[model samples]
Every structure is written in structure tokens, then in C-alpha cells.
Target: MDIKPLLLASGMIAATALAGCSTVGGSVYTASYASITDAGYKLPAIPVSKVPEQYRRQIVSYETKEKPGTVIVDTTSKFLYFVMPEGKAMRYGIGVGKEGFEWSGTARVAMKREWPVWTPPAPMIRRRPELAVYRGGMQPGLQNPLGARALYLYKGGRDTGYRLHGTPEWWSIGKAMSSGCIRLLNQDIMDLYDRVEVGAKVIVK
Candidate 1:
């Protein structure tokens, strides 16, 4: 079977739904996410020991219908819930679209990448040509724009150009930022990525 058509459909659905809707303060600080070469970029040193051991442990919330293999990003609460079976969800802090980019809808995980590359869209480059430097792709690591992982969103089966990925700017959590992508802490994203498989259902609300 031809998967291209199916993939495209899913991408479109994901894009349409996952696109952000709520903006925090109607202020977009572009400089906060200015471009930086991967070589020069680094994740702020964090004391893993200091990171609450409980938070590191998967959280099972009875209120959520999430299963062990699914992903849900609740922008309202600034939480990303990875559903574990028996009405449990592993929740993580998230940074959503600031304002104009905020969106709430349902989607699916069409694909995923580890240490994915960064390719700012043409418009993004147009708005800030400095992004033109990393057109094709970048290496995955502390410097990579996609952080530690990227869970590509889809609707019926098409590319929405939206993603749930990690960011070096851990402080950005709970804020509306990014061109339109859902950003999460590197460690948190890595953990979620490991638990989700391709084609997993994603609900963004």
C-alpha cells in the first residue's frame, strides 16, 4: 500500500489540530529563541540528583484516560501526559505557543526522531534570515534545535509541520514560545519518546 498519501493525510490532521490557539501575554520575544549554532549551544547543567525523584518517576493520574503507549499535551495546564494503562498518565511540564500560535485539538504520533535535526521554515528564515544558516538539517545533541527527541504530529496521516520536541531552553516551560512547536525539557522529552511508538494517538488540548 502507498503510505505517502496516508502520511500526508495524517500530517495535515495533526497540523490543523496541534497548531496552538492560546497566547500567554500577547508578547512574542523573538530574541528569547534566537538562533545559535549547535557547536556553541549547550544545555544548562542540571543537578540530576536535585531533579525530584518523584517527578522522574512516571506519574499515574486517574483522571486521565491515557495509556502507557499514548501521548497527550494539555497546553492549558502546561502539562504533557503520557498515558499508562489503568487510567494512568505520566505528566511532564511543557511550553506551548505563546498566544497566536496556541491551538487545542487531537492528533496522532505519525513519526518520531532521535536527536533530530533543525530546519527552520522558509517564513521563519524570512522573518529572521539568520535561521537560513541551518536550512537542511543539524546534528542531534546539546546544540541540536530538536533537543534530545522529536515526536512528529499528524492528524489523519499528514505532516502538520508541528512537533513535540525538546529544547535547550528548559526555563521556557509554561510559556508560550516557539514558532509553533510544543517544547519540553530535554530529559522529559527523552523519557516520553522512549515510551511512545509510531502511530500513537495524541490529543492536544
Candidate 2:
């Protein structure tokens, strides 16, 4: 007539089930931490702390027809998912373009750079004449708008004039800012830059 053993077994089963659900739903998470020293300036590793919990990098269970290694960006949600096998993805928070600068299309990563120089396109300078000083090109440094890395996007062997790049402005994640290019926290973009290869598929929608 002892019921304690049965109750204990049921509790164990329930706990196990909860753990599995958490893993499948991609609720368990951790933040990235790394010291970034570049261009004579050491950037303190605080991006993880600055970001919201929902925007932190984590493995997520994503349902998509796209193949693994593909980068799918959901601007509406300000999330970028790097597709993986078994319906999983490494998702990160992103800063998308504002209303008029928004763009959606498929492209491939044509190039990758570390501490890339920033050249304000003529049009961009025209919009803000103060940027004229950098008209030739801004040297790569911590203060450069491109931040620590850049992934140039191209379509059909043509430059899209858009990029998936890093920003020192970690606070901008999960917002509609930027001219048109997709932006990520410096630490997050560094992680993404390592995983993504040139010629990888990218879908922004």
C-alpha cells in the first residue's frame, strides 16, 4: 500500500520532461564574453550585459526550410538566426534599418573583414555634410562605424551596398536604426563572423 515510491517516480519524470521542453524550446541560454583589443583601443567586454535577455545569443529551435548554415534575418523581430541541423539555429539580436532604409532580399556573403575602413558613400555624405571629412575613407579603428568586423553582402555577382556588420553601439540592438545595413553588437558580430563563411546564403525578411 506504499504510494511514496510512485509519487517520487512521477516527480522525476515531470522534472525530466521540463528539462527536455526547455532545450527544445530553446529557453536555456548563456551570454558570450571576450576581450576585444583592436586599433590601440581595448574594448571592454560588456556587450552581453548591455543586451536584453531575449536578444542574447542562444541556440534556438527554429522551423525553416532553409538549409543549415543559412542566415535568416527577421527584421520585424530584430533577430538573426543562423540555421543549423535538426531544426536548430544560433540566434542573435540585431539592429535593423529604419523605415525608409529597410530592405528585404536574398544575398550571399561576398567578403569578410576585420577592423574594416569606413567610407561614407557619396550619398550618405550628401545627407550629412559633416561626414564629408571621411569622404575619402575613415581609418579602421574602435571609433569607426563598422566596429570590429564586417560581412559584405552581394547578389548575383553585384554589390548590394548593404552589409552585416558590427557596431560598438551595443545599446542599439533590437531597434530600427542604421541606414540600411544590418548591425550587431561587436561581440555578437565577431562570433557570427567566425561561424559564417564567404558565399554563405543570407535571407533578410
Candidate 3:
């Protein structure tokens, strides 16, 4: 089977939804085209009770300050820390950038979106023409590139366009992967999203 047609079909679905009349939808459809919604896509839920008991507390260690409400991600260790003030951190497993995209820096959460529209950067589209379907912003939905939720980053008040977000691909955790975003499991990100607000400090190193 030729992979090109398969990829092209996926691109068409993404492109069509993005180009469709922009309006909020009342019903949720699991079909790929039905992914986008009014507020944003509702990320699929995986009951925490069902999560493997063994995987619940997967810890990647680092000695960062435990300042209340601050979040830290150590790419080297694939750990995300939610500072808990009393010299302890609540850590979660994460997926970092694919080798060449790995970066270290400090930034702040400039904004947060429940489900964000995604527009491929010129380089990203150039690298994958299939992404050209989204020359305009992709609609917010399960199919959207930003995934379940997006925490936009900023440095000195400028949009960095990089995000810390969730992915449907749960297996990607702890692995290095393409692009400049940080990927978390949907369950983990939903937990983190509930705890963070705009203006939170984010340290990625």
C-alpha cells in the first residue's frame, strides 16, 4: 500500500475541517472530521482509576527549587515538575523534542487554550507538505496539531509559539521526538492544566 495516499487523505480531512465554516458544534463526533468544536476540542478522557497503578508515580529526578505553583520541565530526564513549596515536587513523565529540536531556556505561560487551532510554520509545512492543508489555522479539535490543550510560551512578552500540551499517543512519553513542543499524556496534561493559570513561570532545561 502506498503511504502517500494515506497521508494525503489525512491531510484532506484536516484541511477541509479547517476550511469549513467556523462555528461551534453542539454534538461531539468521534469521526476525524468531527474533531473540531466551538470552544476547542474536548480531549478524550481516560479514567484515572483505570490508569496502571504501577505507572501512576513515574518519577524522573532533578533538584529544582520547590516554589509553590511554579512548573519545571527537565528535558534531559523527561520529567515535568509541579513545584509544591515544601521542598517536594509532583513529577510526571513527558516526551521531549527530537534531538535537533531540543532546547533549554526559561519562559512564562503567556496564555492557555483548552484546544488550540494549529497553523504550521513555513519550515514545518516545507518539511511536510501534507501540512499545507492548514495554511490557515487548523480548527480546534482532536485532529488539531496542538492536541488536547496548549500552554503557549513567551519570553519578554513575545509569542514563542512553542507549547506544552497533551497527545493521544500515550506511548510517546519519555522519548525524544520531532518539533519544538513538549508532549504529555492527555490525563497528565488535564491534571496540570487544572492547576496552572496564565502568567505561571515555566522553566525548561
Candidates arranged by TM-score, highest first: 2, 3, 1
Candidate 3 or 2, higher lDDT:
2
Instruction: List TM-score per model, in order.
Output: 0.71, 0.83, 0.71
Candidate 2 residue runs with Cα over 4 Å from true position: 1-29, 38-41
Q: Mind giving the per-residue lDDT tens digits that candidate 3 earns over 1-205?
A: 7899999978866774543322213321121212323354455544434443322333323355546778888888787887764455556677888978888788899888877778888898899999899989888666565677779999999988689997777667778984978888766676678778789999898
- The lDDT for every candidate, in the order shown, is 0.70, 0.85, 0.70
* Per-residue lDDT value at 150 in model 2: 96
Candidate 1 residue-wise lDDT, 136-176, digit = tens: 86666786768978999888777778899998776677778
Clashes (N, CA, C under 3 Å) per candidate: 30, 0, 1
What TM-score would you give candidate 1 relative to the actual structure? 0.71
Q: What C-alpha lDDT does candidate 1 achieve relative to the native structure?
A: 0.70
Which candidate number would show the highest lDDT if scored against the true structure?
2
* Segments in model 3 whose C-alpha atoms lie over 4 Å from true places: 1-63
* Model 3: lDDT of residue 24: 18
